[model samples]
Target: MELKLPEIPELSRQHRLAAQEQLDRKTKPVGSLGRLEELAVQLCAIQHKVPPDTARKRILVFAADHGITEEKVSAYPREVTAQMLANFAAGGAAINVLARLMGGELFVVDVGVAAEPVVGVKNRKVRWGTRNFAHEPAMTVEETLQALNVGIELAFEAAEDEVDILCLGEMGIGNTTAAAALLCLLTEAREEQVVGRGTGLTDAQLEHKRAIVARAVARHREWVKTPFEALCAVGGLEIAALVGSMIGAAASKIPVIVDGFIVTVAALVAYHLTPKARDALIFAHRSEELGHRYALELLEANPLLDLGMRLGEGSGAALASFLVEAAGRILREMATFAEAGVSEREEQDVT
Candidate 1:
């Protein structure tokens, strides 16, 4: 199948200005809310609503297995991918807990888990798992396009459900290695600059993982000319799906909360594919992963939280959704100075 990327329209400047004006008139001092105020304006602009409806939040966790585990890159075994999907279905994972606490619905899609389909999870498996990229391309162009379509289908389903905001997450063992390779290729960063201890690899293991990423990139760099080709070269199924999800969400005009390093790598691909997708993305946090900083820098994104979080599965995004909702509520519910009958600052008192 030909992977035709959806066209994401640019966010409206008028809506941004209107939201900023409303925020300035709020009872609090101008910009006192800091990033929260900016988030409100962004939400308003994306949704074209004065206060942006954040009533329905959905977290989509794409699960897959990475054949790179054959390289011993991750501290966890490949079986953990399927195990985590079952855990998510059992409502025992960190994301499940956060989604429940934050009133956000959690859905898991088995894009390529290398196992039988787990009950209670959406089955959209493109393959058993991505091929090991250390010696070969991770996925064929057709498989990559199929994975992307799966994500696009899910995003449209969320739109059908009237979800106001979407959060992107993933559960794929050894995916960090895939993400690191893709990051190195996309950002032209050295292996050390983009490789990190995934699932707590020791210093020596981390070094070995870096070498593997270096080798993989060296093998594929010459032919990986475009973002799509880069994904096919070194990206995992879940990563490609997340890329599609961002594009589809942007096309649907629904803001997406991007999770950590792996998800951020997917965001980088989506941004390169369609720069306007950045307007529909809300970065959730800065992961402890070393490569996350490079991905964030590449996208010029300032995430909402930075509590040294590296746990994927949308945990960071789930926490950040509360802030997104709070920003919307602040714009919708907070009383303006005039409505509250409060005195404004003196015209000469700029400070």
Candidate 2:
């Protein structure tokens, strides 16, 4: 089944101009806030409002298992995918803790766990796990479409809850292997350029992982013709869901703060599917993962933080939520020069 792609909302040029004017009138010199100022403008354009309101937030942590895990590409075993989802549901995971601290409601989705259901995770399993991509396509085209549809539904539900911002996270063992393959195929990147030591794989294991990615890309070269095809051939269930969520958020006029490497891989898929969705994505951080930087450059995204965070499951996005919320507050509450009775310097002099 082909995806019924939503009509993504257009960024409002009028609101963007208004936001720039407001920032210039603020007490600080023009462009003093640098990227924060750019963020405020982008947020305003995204919400189609003069000053954006980012009070409500939701983080969706998608868990799935990858057949590539069977290859010992990761240090952690495949069972950790389900265990981490339970930890997330119990509020014991890093993402859970950070989401709570950042004031974001957390939702765990079991897209393809390869195990029995966890109590608190919403079971939306496409399959127990993907087929091994090293030997064949990871998923059928229909399964890829189904995963994307699930993500769109989740985003619409969050929008109904009045969520102003949506964050993307994932927990799928050996999924990094899937992401690396997708990146290599989509960007025509060398396997060594994008593959890395996922979950602390030993040097030899990392090399083996690279070879696996290379083999997958070579075997599925024809399937990389389109974003949907690339996804079916090498993408994980969680990664497909992230792509749909991003597209849905764009359609709903809500910003989706993307987590790290794996999440960015999904973002790349979303952007490739609908180039406009790129406007709605807020990259949370630059992950320590080697492929992340290349993905970000391809997306033209500047992440909000870089604390050496490579842990996915939305922890990075949740932490970056604080900054996104702060941007809205800064734009809404900061005093204008006229209101503050402050002398304004000439535009040329300020710089």
Candidate 3:
């Protein structure tokens, strides 16, 4: 049978209803808990517990280089991709800083940067970097499999640690071009709707980048008929590895919080690879990337943030964690109406 997108987490509707019923019994006006009550119920389902708690969060950043840099699609240089890996390892990158603030650990993987693997850094690079897609296929199937295996191995390590929640991020210049190209291939969007200025592009540069991606997609339109094949054509190693991370999270039953465009594109690829991954994921945001909303819509996800953020450091997912926390608190810590000795009226009267 053909693969289908992963199921959303099998939250107990009965249990969620029960939790909400208890929330209704809280000593406050009906629906007074606002978003927290909703969050609590969401948490209840993900944790498979009446209440949820995110005690340990894990953020995985897959760093790599895209061959499309040869097309001048990004403002940052390809060398920056490897340099940022060091920044992440040294806890100086934006994602690392955010993880520190949230007390979450940051793990960086060298999926496919073009440079030799840095010393003292975890070596997960499948290759130095993928070949430029402008002239040839981005990666061979063997390389893709290697990249996926690397991601799975890292995720298995996290699962062994019992990470409660997972966030996916990536570091690669010219990566957004790959994502946009993937969007055009995976969704009903076109070049204009999917392209965005990644890391600051001039208006002229954005147009140039868009045309390059459009040309890339046009060249590969035959493969565009299916999602996974399309990703294989233009997707970066870090992006592909992120896809495997999503798959590993689902297989391990850990909730996966997707970052912005690059990570979400990886998520899209993973869902196609194994549909069940959709069930264990939460949308971290409606990203600023031009194609992010299209990808989220294709997944039928509602992210917790829409700060016009296009920064792809798993930072958006980190911010969204606060909402997940609120949900857990309401489910696990809120006092019910009867417990608080508050008065209650009929449901008809409350509404």
Model 2: per-residue lDDT, tens digit, 106-156? 999999999999999999999998989998889998999889988999999
Candidate numbers, best TM-score first, in rank order: 1, 2, 3
Off by over 4 Å in 1: 348-351
The numbered model that scores best in lDDT is: 1
Query: What are the runs in model 2 whose C-alpha is more than 4 Å off?
Result: 346-351
Question: TM-score for each prediction?
Answer: 0.97, 0.97, 0.91
Query: Please, what are the lDDT tens digits per residue for candidate 3 over residues 1-351?
Result: 222323335545776787777777777787877776776776666656665657788888888888889888888888998788777777787887788788887877788888888764678877778777777778887787777777776777888998888888888888899889888887768899989998999999999998898788888886656666776788888887788778777766677788898888888888777776777788889887888888888888888888998888788988887777666766677777788786777657555
Q: State model 2's lDDT.
A: 0.90
Per-candidate RMSD, Å: 1.5, 1.9, 3.0
What clash count does candidate 3 reach?
10
lDDT ranking from best candidate downward: 1, 2, 3
Residues 219-331 of candidate 1 have per-residue lDDT tens digits of: 99988889899999999999989999998999988999999999999999988888888889999999999999999998899998999988999999999999999999999
Predicted structure 3: lDDT: 0.79
